[model samples]
Target: MLTIVNDFLWGQILIVALVGAGLLFTIGSGGVQFRYFGRMFSVLRRGFHHEQGHISSFQALVVSVAGRVGSGNIAGVAVAITLGGPGAVFWMWVIGLMGMATSFFECSLAQLFKRYQPDGTYRGGPAYYLTHGIGQRGLAIIYSVLLLVTFGLGFNAVQSYVVATSLQASFGVATWVTGLVMVLGLAVVIFGGIRRIAVVSELIVPLMALMYLCAALLVIGMNITAVPAVLGHIVQSAFGLEQAVGGGLGVVIMQGVKRGLFSNEAGLGSAPNVAAVAHVPHPVNQGIVQAFSVFIDTIIMCTCTAVIILLSDVYQPGASDVDGVVLTQTAMAGHLGSWGAGFVSVALVLFAFSSIMYNYYLGDNSLSFFSDENPLVANIFRVLVLALVFWGSLQDLSTVFGFAELTMGLLAVVNLFGLVWMYRIGVRLLRDYDGQLRSGKETPRLRTEDWTDLDIDERAWRD
Candidate 1:
């Protein structure tokens, strides 16, 4: 049943919605993702500066990136190749490109409709936007529940499963031991709230990414002669022009889209939950920053893993027994010897650990929509999340991934529906930001007074 639902969602409904909506948003926004490509860095650089006690835009970005650049980059990429072939990497690239625009709109809307919390913080996401932007309280509730289930429970389980399996494959560590360590570490950080998560992500995300990229670069350097052949094969396999490990073109596309969305989370609506937490002068600023994060995750981080695996001799085109984190681990070991496997295991721990933190925040934020920020309710939710993390370690890969994919598809559908319906408002925010830039302002600021017709939180945006 889970596989059937996932097949329908990934093979039919979601691929169209994700690609079509991304194209629409890209065209509708005048290719804002492209136009602001360089500007994203500038916005991110400025994002480092924030008012005291507020979440800086850069912090918010790393939190979203932490959520994105996890097991999906390493284990998920391996799964794509195992099932979809090298061609799936091409589709992953395609989705990453289109997803940038989709991320921008969703995140901008999140920032726009965000609520001002009494604790001098912000709270918002698709749930807040649905109710506050379109007067749909019931839909908001549904989105909140799905968010809680998808990120809070389903996706976090997937992360735990990946890390546990990777560690067991590499170091002979017991999966149960890994689960307990992860649960204990996660409990300490999550209880500290979003700020601590942000700080930890800020430190770990950059350093870990750099180390992983350097490792990939070393592999690419060693296999410099095969670089052209590997690149050509990925493109050829994507079109079924070459016989490869995965099935036909359909399987290639499906795997790519599924794993790609899983990796970067462009249109999945997960990033917006964190995007809404940033203290930015204009909503579009954070939107641009978030868009850049998708690029970092899929284009940079995921591609590194793909190159490492494909460039390795251990990766046979159609191997059956080797898959998931083990494939990645084996491929790395084949390159850098035994230590290579250890490196991947350590990297997975850091990546998935940060993701657990990011995922916890999303679930906690979603609970706020229903519980009115009740402390007891929040603690209970944390306990449930911790339980899932441990439970995930004992489960098989397929079961955990299938459940996560099903819930993620449902959540994306709801969020995409809201994005399509609220298209014009997204455009207006873009134009307003552009208008300010054209008027010679170095930083575009949101003037809440100008959007009187919209249900924006005035106190949240007040200078």
Candidate 2:
């Protein structure tokens, strides 16, 4: 019964809504993700103009990328390949491309409706916009509660569990040992609050991502002769034309979309929570940055993992026992001998650890909605998240994953509906941003007066 419910939520309902909304945003924004792809790096290079003690646009991008580039990029991609075959990889690319638009609109909206905290930090997400932008407190509260469970407890546990299992598999380490180390590390970063989290993420995310990508490229370089054929297999298999596996087109697309969501988190409403933290002069600036993050997470990081697994001789589709992170570990080992498993174990630790901190920030930001400026609320939630991280390391995989999927599905539905309802605002913001650029402005800063009717925190946008 539980499995059926989760499948319905993730495989059926959420997929349609997620993809449909993404398409809608893509058409609505006139391909903002494509038109301004180059401008994203320019805006990032312009650097941060944040308030005292607040994070810059790049820091927020790093924090968001930290969350997006986690176990999902490694384990989740493996799962997609195992279930959906090489074709699944092609669909993953499609989702990544479309999701860029979804990410842009939602993140820009997050910035538009973000609330300023007393300590000069910013907090916002689907909940803030649902309440202030759509004027529905009930919907906002539900969104917050769902986010609290999905990221704070469920997703964090999943991260810890993946790291623990990978370590146990690769190095004969106990799950409890990994849990203890994870708890200690999580405490130091999460307790220091968002700025500390942002700082650490900025440092670790880039270094770790570069290291993992370099390793993947090394493997791919060695198998350069097989690259073109493997790429062809991915496309053919996606349409049920390849005969290696029997998941059919439906299963292929489902696995690709599901794993893609897990990796990039474009329309899921999670990334926007951190995207709202950046003190960019204009909301679309961070929107573009967040959109670029989707590219990095899915197109670059997840694709790297996909290539690693697909290029390996060890990959066996439809092998029920060899799936998930173990499959990825095996593939890496096939490429680099026994040391590959150890390398992946270390990579998972870094990937999952940064994600746990990023998850805490989302939960902490949600806590602000229910109990404004209340330290106790955030403190209690912090304890709960940490406790779950420890407990998840020891819990069964099915339980943790199922719980995560259920909550995340609900969170996506709520957030996607809000995005669809207020998508015009996204279009309007993009137009406003593009207008400034076309008028010869180098760096476009938003004026609160431009969006007079919206419930924007004027102080946030005021120059």
Candidate 3:
């Protein structure tokens, strides 16, 4: 039943909605993602500078990246290849490209409608935007609930299961032991609140991503001669020119879209929860940074995993036994010997741990939408999240992934509809930033007065 619903959602509904909204956002934003590609790096440099009590743009970005570059980059990529062939990788790239624009719009709107908290932080996401931007409190509640289920419960479980399985495969550790250890470690940071989550993600995300990329580079260099052929195979398989897998083009496209969205979460409404927390000069600046994160997550990190797997001789087109993180680990071990598996296990632990922290923060944020930051409610929510983490570690891969995908698909549907409905507001925010830039402002600050007609919290943008 779970698989049936996920297949329909990913195949029929989400594929069209995801692609269509991405294309629409791309056109509506006047190709902002491309036009400001270089500007993204510049903005990121400034991101290191932020108000003392608030989160830096860089910290927010890394937290969001932590959430994105998790099991999806490793296990999910392997699954895509196993089920849809090399052609799925091509479609993943396509979604990454299109998702950049969608990310820009959604993240910008998040910043635009973010609320200023008394604790000297900001809070917002699709829920805040749906309520404050469009006056849709009911829709906001629905989005918050979906977000809570998808990230807080669903994705965290998936992450825990991936990490637990990876450890078991590499170190021969019992899954239950790994689950207990993970639960204890997660409880430490999550209990410390969002600032601690930001600090941990900041320190871990860059280091882990860099190390993983270096390992992937070594593997690609070892198989440099075969690189061109592999690239050609992906393209050919994508178009059904090469029958590498029996599923054909539809399956190839579906797998890529699903895995790609899972990896980067560009338009899935997940990243915006952290994107709203950044103290940037303009909302679009954070949006640009978030857009670059999608690039990093998919184009850089996920491609590294895909290339590593495709380059390894262990990866057969239809290998059912070796799938998920095990496939990735086997491919790594084949490339660099036994120690390679250990390296992948360590990397996955870091990746999935940070993702769990990120997932917790998103869930906590959503809980606030209902409980208004009540300590009892927050603590109860945290306990539930930890319980799910433990439960997920004991579950099989199919169970965790299926549940996460279904809930994720539903979350995306609501957020995408809200994004499309509130498209003009996103555009206006972009134009405001663009106009300031054109006027030669070094860093364009959002003046809330310009948006007096909207329900924006002026305190968030106060000078």
**lDDT comparing candidate 3 with the true structure:** 0.89
Lowest lDDT sum, 10 consecutive residues, model 2, at 314-323
For lDDT, the strongest prediction is 1
For each candidate, what is the lDDT?
Answer: 0.90, 0.88, 0.89
At residue 434, candidate 1 shows an lDDT of 93
Q: In candidate 1, what are the lDDT values of residues 172-273, reduced to their tens digit?
A: 899999999999988888998888889889999998889899999999999999989999999999999985753678888888988898789887788999
lDDT of 3 at 235: 92
Q: Clashing pairs in model 1? A: none
Candidate 3 lDDT over 225-266, as tens digits, reads: 998998888898899887667777888888898889878887
Q: Count the backbone clashes (under 3 Å) in each candidate.
A: 0, 1, 0
Choose 1 or 3, whichever is better by lDDT.
1
Candidate 3 clashing pairs, residues 3+ apart or interchain: none
Q: What TM-score does candidate 1 get on C-alpha atoms?
A: 0.96
TM-score of each: 0.96, 0.97, 0.97
> RMSD, model 1, all Cα superposed?
1.6
- In terms of lDDT, the poorest run of 10 residues in model 3 is 314-323
lDDT of 2 by residue, 7-60 (tens): 888888988998998899989888888988998889888755566878999999
